[model samples]
Target: MTLRRRILILATAVVLLGAVGVFAVLRASSRAAEKDRAQDGGPRVTRGEVALAPGDGGRRIVFRNMAWGPHRDELATVAADVPEGPRTASGVNCLRFHSAAGTGICLRADRGGVAESHRAVVLDAHLEERSSHPLAGIPTRARVSPGGRLAAWTVFVGGDSYAGTNFSTRTSILDLRTGRLDASLEDFAIRKDGKEYRNADVNFWGVTFAADERTFYATLATDGKTHLVRGDVVERTVTTLRENLECPSLSPDGTRLVFKKRVPGLPAEAPWRLFALDLASMRETPLAEERSVDDQVVWSDDRTVVYSLPGDFGADLYALPADGGGVPKRLMPSALAPAFLD
Candidate 1:
């Protein structure tokens, strides 16, 4: 072919590709704008004062609002007894969130630049930002100690998804009182099978703090196996308690744990079954969900556990008996990462 003709054909292809790209961008923008509008039959949400500290409101549940509207993704609260009631939105937005006592850890994205960045914001009782730390990647799980003195979060530093084996995670813990930050839990000593263990592929996530401010539990992945590890803030050590457990949330009473177990014979996409572990007996009781749950559950009380499942808008909260009996019940629609303040 002639050089002039070849140049003309290349230029034509470039123009067509540019036009398609612009069309895709416009279409995505339109879809995203729709999320800002309230859908019919959606839960009612209004801007109001939300306190992490328990007072006046008696008992309430604070969660990341997944309902579509102007207040979507903000931290919102409702009476614990009436979870499906009208919500009071707190203007604070978080991709992953958890709170305890009067402290909250909000993992949110900073989209001000060309590339999106994430940060963990330490929030007070009034949902005010106390401090913020830049995150290395996409935020996933977040938790604050029961006494509000410590906070921890896990982010997928590199990976397509947490369910895949090739993913990497960075779990960090911050001490509110001392202003100390452990950027990665990998720095802590690990004890497996009653011996010191070390591996380059160790990753930690899904931290759940115990009543004692110094003790915490988390999922530690190493050597292609996941284990429930008990960590000590002061000792700087983590001891593996059991294998094949991931994303453990310690019970309020500190006697048991609600976690996702990789049950055999399940589909790869949904391999987890919610199970309750008795810390004393090392016993695992499978809950009655009969479906896979990928969340790190939160104990609504000492007897019941709450978790998120995929919903129409984003995710929905559901409650189940911690004893592995009874049926799963939807707690709230369009909600994720719930924390009960009493």
Candidate 2:
């Protein structure tokens, strides 16, 4: 072909690609605008003061509201007793959130740039921003210490899900009182089977803080297996407690842990089942929830646990008996990452 004809062909191809890109952007914009509009038959949401502190209403359940409306993805609250009632939106948006003793950790996304970014924001009792730190990847799990002096969060630095063998996660713990941050838990020393351990593929995520400020529990994945690791903030070490458990949420009384156990013979897509492990006895009891639960459960009380499941809008909260006997009940619709204030 002639040089002029070749140049013309290249120009035509560039124009076609530009048009396709514009179409994709327009489609995405349209979908986002649709989310801003209130969906018919959805729960009522109103802008209101949503304090992290427990008020006269007794106890409140703060969660990431997933209902379709103007307040979608905002940190909202409801009476702990009546979780399915009207939501009070705090105007603070978060992809993942958790709170304890009036302090909150909110993992939020920044959508303004060409590539999306995430950050962990510390919030005061009044739902106001206290501090923010940039996160390396997509946020997943977040938790605050029982006394509210420490905050922990986990993000997916690679791959799509925790179940994937090639996935990588970065778990960070922040000292709220001193403003100190542990950017990655991998920096801490690892002790497996009473021996010091190290590996290039080691990844950590799904942290749950104990009442004691120095102690915590998290999932450490290495060598195609996940373990429940007991970590010490002061010692800067993590000791493996048990294997095949992920996302362990300790009970308020600190006697047991409710975690997702990868049960054999289950489908790979949904391999986890809720199980309660007695810390003292080293015994595991499978919870009644038949479906797979892929969340770091929140202990609603000593006897009950709450977790999120895929729902119509996005995700819904479900409560189950800690004893592994009672059936799972829908706690609330269009809610995720619940933190109870009492």
Q: Tens digit of lDDT per residue, candidate 2, span 1-342?
A: 999999999999999999999999999988765664448565678788999987888888999999988899999988888888778888999999999998999999999979999999999999889999999999999999999999999999888887667678999999998998999999999999999999998999889888988899999999988999999998899999999999999999999999999999999889999999999999999999999999999999999999999999989899999998989999998899999898
lDDT of 2: 0.91
**Once model 1 is optimally superposed onto the true structure by TM-score, how far is the C-alpha of residue 274 displaced, in angstroms?**
0.6
- Residue 267: error of model 2 in Å? 0.7
The digit string of per-residue lDDT tens for model 1 on 247-273 reads: 998988899999999988998888999
Global CA lDDT computed for model 1: 0.91
Q: In model 2, how large is the Cα lDDT of residue 38?
A: 48
Looking at model 2, which ten-residue stretch has the lowest summed lDDT? 33-42
Global lDDT of each candidate: 0.91, 0.91
Q: Enumerate residue pairs that collide in model 1.
A: none
